[model samples]
Structures are given as C-alpha cells and as structure tokens.
Target: MDVRVLGRGPAEPFLGAQDLFETEYDLSMPVRVRIRRDPDERTWTGHYPDHHVLNISAQAATSAMARELALHEYAHMRRNEEAHPSHTQSTAEALYLALAGRRVERRKLTHCYQIANHMKDIYADDITLSVAPADKLVAFLEASLATALADRPHDPPRWQRLTPAADPDITAVNAAFALALCERHDLLTPDHRLYDLAHAAADDAPGVSIERFKHRFKTLVDDPDESEYRKALVDVTHQYAVETGQAAD
Candidate 1:
C-alpha cells in the first residue's frame, strides 16, 4: 500500500489503519491513499481489480472513526475483489428492474438508493465486525438517528414534507437498517436504547412499517449469489416504494 498525501493532512491515521487492517487481511493489489486538504471533500474508497484508491477528507482523517471506516472500506475492497453479489450488482439496476413502470417521485428516488446502500453496508459490516469491535459503528448509528429525529421540523406532519437531512421517513428507514444490522449481529440487548429510537422513528413515519423492513433486511443470507442479491434488492425496493407511497400513480 502506498500512502500519498494530496494537499495537506496527517497520513498517520490512514497508515495506522492500513497496518491494523493488514494485520488480519492480505492486501493483494496496490492501494493508493489520497488525503485531501479540503475538509468538505467526501471520503470514499474505490475498488478495482488491479488497484484500489482511498480518498479521505482532512477533517475525516482526524475523526475517531477513521480506522474503523478504513477497515469497513477495505472490507468492501476485499468483497469487490471476490466479486461478491453485494459489490457486483448495481443497486440502480435493481431499482430499475423493481420500479421500471411505477410512478416514483424524484424526491423519493434517493431513498431507494439509500436503502440499497444499506444492503451493501450489511455485507461490508459483516467482514468489518469480524475483526473490529462494533462499538464505534453502533454508536455512530445511534447518534445519527437520534440527531435526525431531534432536528425534525415542527411544521406539518413529518410524512407531509421531506427535508433531505431530517426527513422522518428516511430516518425511520435508517433506524430500521440500524436495528436490523445490530440485531443480525446480536450486538444490542432486548432493552437497548436503540430500540426506543427505532420506535420513535416508526411513530414519526406512519406510512413506513419499520418492523417489517427490519425483519426483511435482517434475514439476508450470508454471501448470496448475484441473482439472489438482485432479487432481494428488487423485492426490498418495490416494498419500500409501495409502502412509502412513492409508487402511487
């Protein structure tokens, strides 16, 4: 792995993370790490068969979750190398297959992609959680959902209006994903506080059945084939579209 600093930021975090990750997983191909000076730049990892690139915002590189985030992205890299169904199939393709002729609003289209992302995250986290502790990931989800819920608008019912960040319907879906992931790993107890947050999100978005989606996403089989993954993605997308009133003509 080659660490390349783009503008200005500490590369030590990434180096440390790479060391930690390489301790458990083998790095077969070359990896380039780009650290951007801009704090606002989006942090992500791009996986290719020949090489891999990791881009990190200066701000994100300083965060506490940097190592865990790197591990998660590296897990994605490994899966992509293996041609895992979650990494091979494009969610957009599945969305099209699921709602080709349906009348879905442009605004709600983002949610479909977000839900698809949750499915991919589930598989990546499966690898990540095996090596790293789930503490940071779990904490991040709880804090994020709690903040979204607390920042919800006061005007009109939550389902009536959609703000990109604090939309209750999206928050509900996020909570469902969090609950499903945690439950699938047995990370939370029956009386955990996240359950309360999930319940609160469900109450805020009456149109979405959070429990059903939770169960649906939670039972995903491990290492499914390409067809199975696409089928699950399409089924979940269609269900979410219809349940959230996005498929209405």
Candidate 2:
C-alpha cells in the first residue's frame, strides 16, 4: 500500500499512524494524507475502492493528537472497505422508513442522522481502540462535551431552535453519543466528568431519553449484516422522532 503525506506539516506522525493501523488491518488501497488549514474542518477520511485520502486540518496535524485522530479515520477507512453497514447504508432512507407517515420536523430529522453517525463512530472507535490507547480519544470527548455544555444556554429561547448548535435535542443526542462511547469502551467510572455532563444534558432535555438512544447505539452487534444494521437504524430513528414529539398524531 502506498501512503503519501502531501503537506508541509510534519509527515512522521501520520506515517507512524499508518504503520500502527496497518498492523491490525490491511490497507489495500493507496492513501493520500492532505493537510488543510481550516480549524473548523475536522480530520476525516474519504474512501474510494482503489484509493483513500485522509484529510487533516493544519491545527490538528501539528498537534500531538494527530496520530490518534488518524487512527480513528483509518478505522473508518477499514470499515468502508469491509462494507460495514454503518459506513454503507443510507441513514436518511432508514429514518423515512422508520417514521413513515409521521410528519417530523426538519431539525428533528437531522438529529436522527447525527444519531446514526454516532453509531458509525462507535464502530470505528472499536477498531481504533483495539489497536491504540483510548486515552487521547477519551480526552477529546471530554474536552468537546465540556465546551458544549459551557456554551449551552440556561434556558434557550424558542427562536434558538433554528440553530442546531443551540437546539436541546441536538445536545441530548450529543450526550447520548458520549454515554454510548463510554459504555462501549468501558471507560465510565463514578468519578468521570462525562457522567455529570451527560446527566446535565438529560436533565436539560427531558423529552429526549438519552438512555434509550445510548443503549440502541452502544449495543449494536459488531459486523452486523445489512438487515440487522438497518433495523437498528430504523428503531433509533423512530424512537427519536417519537420522543421529540415529531410524530404527527
């Protein structure tokens, strides 16, 4: 496999990450590592059957966390190669089928996609954590949730619903994702900071049951066949729509 780093930024970290990931998984395709300067654009992987690209923001590539981030994206690339349901299926179609005839708000429907994405992340992290330490990934999640919680409104105005970042449902799903990751990796402890933030999110969005979504996503069977994964997606979408009062009576 040809792995090329295409940036002025240091290539050692990314190349080292490729070596680590290749130990556990076969990277059969060529890979290009592109570094961009956009802070808001996160490190992500784009995959085609024959080749893949791992794009990292300049800020992230320069940071010590680059290897961890690259490993996570590499796991995603591996899953894509394997045709994993989380990486292959249409989340929107699953939501439409799950909530058929129910008029869902566009915002709520969007949240469903985020929930589905959390599932994908969980599976990808499973592969990553197997090959690397979980400390960096765990720390990243903690810092992200802490920031979001600090920025959240004590009581968001009804008008803030127009923004997903300000939407309580979005926060609830975010919290669920945090909880699901902790659960899947057995990272939770009584003193862990995530416990409090997740509880705060749950209390803030009483209409959305964080546990329900957390359980559904966290317990998804590894290497699930298409039907099983689709069913899981449908179930979570329907549950989220109903909980958020998106179902037309």
- TM-score of each candidate structure, all chains considered together: 0.92, 0.92
lDDT of 1 by residue, 59-115 (tens): 787799887877777778777877889888988799999998888876578889999
* Cα lDDT listed for each candidate: 0.83, 0.82
Stretches of candidate 2 above 4 Å error?
A: 156-165
lDDT, candidate 1, residue 141?
93
Each prediction's RMSD to truth: 2.0, 1.9
Clashes of 2: 0
Clashing pairs for predicted structure model 1, backbone only: none
What does the lDDT come to for candidate 2?
A: 0.82
